[model samples]
Target: MQHQPDFSPAADRNKQPILDMLLRVLAPQGSALEIASGTGQHAAWFAAGLPGWAWQPTEVQPEALASILAWTRSQGLANVRPPMLLDVASPDSWPADAQFDLVYCANLIHIAPWPVCAALMRASARLLAARGKLITYGPYLESDIATSEGNIAFDASLKQRNPAWGLRALDEVAQEAASAGLRLAGRHALPANNLLLVWERAEH
Candidate 1:
């Protein structure tokens, strides 16, 4: 059998931590829509663990989506649906009929431009039911402290790779979520200087 290389070593290392957070925040039974489901590793792991919930992994990049589907098929995980083509920046491009109890995105905000993050918040707000959750994981700058030197170096590298890409400020993200009618529920520090940000739709 030909070996297929897993594209994301970081995803492999962080899957367990991300899963732990999801298990705590996600509803007992409902659908979860994962945005930018790169490599499909997290989706496969989460779907297998939470068999009661449907996992829909989506990616905007064609190559990434193809990899996701291939990985899902290889794992033979029944709960994980085939990857959908989704662009966070395109609100209308989202599946209109699908409603999710949780909208999860990992390691995407900083890699994408600011407009994409804004669009993600708006789209997530629209997709989630009242009181539903939106979970995001990645590196961010907190208000009280200077960004860690490692994170600063990482940000510089990201910017060098793409001017639009870099670490985001937690406070700004929280404010944007609030503007979208979502309230910050909690922030959990994770390995490798990443953070798991949980937000819930605010009561009208």
Candidate 2:
């Protein structure tokens, strides 16, 4: 039997919207490192959309590499590199001597242990170029904004599945980035009540 790529309905639906935001925020040309490239849907979509960007997709699950490759290969996107094995929780799992203009991660922090969030910030800090940005997209809890009922329920269900997994507050996420010498540079509200946040080097 041939290997089949995993698909996410949500990713399929939201890829265009997310690409629209990326078009608005990203530079004309640069390198991008995508963390937790789940299902490889986003990697293919974004790589096709941002033709000038060289996209490197990484995932902790070795099994996921095939799916990522399948998707990107099907798209015939030369800009999308082969998927790499990466675990945000492991400091040594990141690519050595690599610096990307953008580190993009979507919908992973809320489903993983809290430590992964901190580790992501630290690793991103080390991998981003001086003027690079870390862009994260997902539903997040905010102290100032009223939480959507759907997000609240989603958060509850996540905690039910794993006590360590739940929606993280935006402020708390910012603090972790700050600890890693990054700062919240931009925040954009996207469809489905999700937020796309941009973090850049603190000194830059």
Candidate 3:
């Protein structure tokens, strides 16, 4: 029997909303590099939504490559390139001399080690074009905003699974971005307490 690609119900639910935001923020044509293209569902959905944009989906796990490829093929997405293995913590894992107009990462930082946040910021800053934007989507804690009960539970559960893993504070994440020469440009509130943030070169 042929192997089937893994599916995320969350991915399916959020893909359209995410694409809607993408259409608003991005230009008509450009190159996009997805940092953690898990399951390739968002890659396929966004590629289809933004027909003129060239999308390259990447994963850190070798096992995930198959699922990404399967999803891309199933969708017949010509705009999406083959998914590549990219470990944000390892600079050696990134594609050298490559630049993209958009670096997209969603729901990744919280699950990974905290160091990964700084690594991601550094990598995104280096890979993005002069006018490029780095868009990250996930639940984040904010000093000014009260934490939702659901998010509190979710954060606790994440930390329970791995002490280093939990919802990150927006302020700290912004500081990391600043240290990497990137700045928070926009913040949009989406469903499920998630925030879609846009980061751009500080000097740009």
Largest lDDT belongs to which candidate? 2
Q: Which tens-of-lDDT digit does each residue in 29-72 have in candidate 2? A: 99999999989999999999999999999999999999999999
lDDT of 1 by residue, 86-168 (tens): 99988777989778888999999999998887888989998897767899999999889778889999999999999999999
Residue pairs with backbone overlap in model 2: none
Ranking by lDDT: 2, 3, 1
Model 2's alpha-carbon lDDT is 0.96
lDDT of 3 by residue, 33-80 (tens): 998899989998999999999999999889999998888888888999
Q: Evaluate all candidate structures by whole-model CA lDDT and list the values in order.
A: 0.87, 0.96, 0.94
On a 0 to 100 scale, what is the lDDT of residue 103 in model 2?
99
Residue 40 of model 3 has an lDDT of 88
Runs in model 3 with CA error above 4 Å? none
The window of 10 residues in a row where model 1 has the poorest summed lDDT is 1-10
Instruction: For residue 113, give model 3's deviation from the true position in Å.
Output: 0.8
Task: For candidate 3, give the lDDT of residue 4.
Answer: 84
